[model samples]
Target: MTAIVVAGGGLAGAAAAAALARAGRDVTVLERDAAPAHKICGEFLSVEAQASLAAIGFDAAVLGGHRISRLRLVRDDAAVSVGLPFEGLGITRRRLDAALLDHAASCGAVVRRGVAIRGVDCSDGLRLDLAGEAPIRPDMLLLATGKHDLRGVRRQAAEPEALVGFKMYFQLNPAARQALAGHIDLILFDDGYAGLQMVEDGMANLSLLVDRARLQRVGGTWTALLADLVKRNTLLADRLIGSVPLLEQPLTIFRVPYGFVHRPTANDPDRIYRLGDQAGVIPSFTGDGMAIALHSATRAANAIIAGHTASAYHRALRRDISGQIRRAAALYRLARMPLAQRALFGVAGTFPSLLRLAAQYTRVPPRARSALY
Candidate 1:
């Protein structure tokens, strides 16, 4: 059997490599980073995401550092809290990535760290150019490089422009921690949305997602914009100000791009496949990015094991990922509209039951609604 080459050793790549190895295929994963690194994220997984993780036999205990049972939607002075039908897990990217990598290695995958992929040629089989080592040719090439564009792939012109993400860890006062325990708070303002949740080590993870223009309007620094947001949002100010202590230097990820690939490589139907963010990214607000990637990887591996062609894998990926992306995009677009945002949140706050119903809707699997009730 020909070896499968997976690029980017993040969650998606590692998961895909593991799945393929488990299916009795030789897999090699090339990662630029040597080990798990810190990343900026909400760190709160929805119930649906947890279910996906469980399906892959991942132990929830590894993510038990911080567990939340409530989801709070906040706007200015008013807030509505809804108890999640199921609990959500909170784990840092560092821990999650390390766990996935370890699992992939144990499953017989050859993980090559500190190796950067200079470029790829998919015309004749799959050729990968490494920075220091001689070029390698593999039977299949999987692109899982999250948010980073590779040179050969053709990106759609109509895709959404990348957004910026800012995050940091902090220690909160005992009173504040007590109030925030078992709850994930989402704060929405005119600029964008910010989320707060507790993670391992008795610290809270705070993240802000904002457009570049809005960041500029508030002064380039996220700290500056955050301060302004706090001043405008009294509830958030009261809960965090003077109580939360910064745990690490605030981190920022610029131009985190996302979109779909309309045209799969026509010339090379035998070798090329896209996975994870490289395939496309769902809006972060939906909290399903990692789950979608993992699910796609599994589906792709199954297709390969069944001896299906690359075109079949492409169609399957589109079918699985497009629906969720559309739903998330619609919700994100609605949130961007001032009037719609006000009305949606206003209605949600007025009728707590409605919020619960929405959560249920979000939690339902794509084709398993009959089983959900």
Candidate 2:
């Protein structure tokens, strides 16, 4: 059998490579970065993500990240706290991706770092064009580049009103730290919302999304936009009282095609398999992106092992997660509307179980039954 080539050594790529290599199929992972670095992500691992990681032979419990047992929604002064259906972990993508890729290497997969892919040509088999390197054509290819599109396989155009995202790390004051322990806070303000949670050490990850117009109106600078948001958001203001920023500046990602789901097309003659954000981009607030990546990795691996067509795999993944993605997108829209935000919060406050139910519905079905194994 010809070796399989996976682009982007991210959560999905590394996990899929590990699964395929462990099953005695040759696999190679190509990552552009020479070393692991932070990526723009919420970094919250749900139960499904954990199970998929375990199936890929990685132990998430040993990652030393924070334990998040509940989710709290805060809007100005009104707030509601609800129990999360499952305990989640707060670990950065930098750490998680590095560890999982290392696991792939240890599991007999050839892991190649600092190798950038220019594009893929499938007219005759699969030809991968590399930057300043010789091209190789493999039997099958898996595209796992998260939030990024390879030159040949980009997703459809994102909605015009795409949101801008920002992420920063901080060491909160004693009072704020104690108050935020064991919880993931989703704070809302005008035209945007933020999710803050503890991860690993005493450090906190604060990731926020703002409408593009709102960002442009504030001078199109991270500093200006963040200051305005903090002033308008009471809960976020309190959390940053005495915090020190860990990064010189926040990491930002652009052109995020939120709610994008890949459907097999006639142009996919290369039989390329799309994974992670390439497969679908669920709204970030739902915190199911990582789970989808892990689950997609295993499912894709299974498909290849079973000699299934790429279109068949794409259809199955789309069928499995389309409803969850749509529901989360609707919730994201409702959370942004001023009037609907208040009403949604009111309902969530009245029946906290509703929040749990939303979480359950937004998540792709668990893999324990299990297609992912």
- Displacement of residue 118 (Cα, Å) in model 2 is 0.6
Top candidate (lDDT):
2
**What pairs collide in candidate 2?**
none
The local distance difference test score of each candidate is 0.75, 0.88
TM-score of each: 0.91, 0.97
Report how far off residue 315 is in candidate 1 (Å).
1.2
Off by over 4 Å in 1: 157-159, 243-248, 258-269, 360-373
For candidate 2, what is the lDDT?
A: 0.88
Deviating ranges (above 4 Å) for candidate 2:
157-161, 367-369
List, residue by residue over 84-116, the lDDT tens digit for candidate 1: 767777778888878888888888899998999
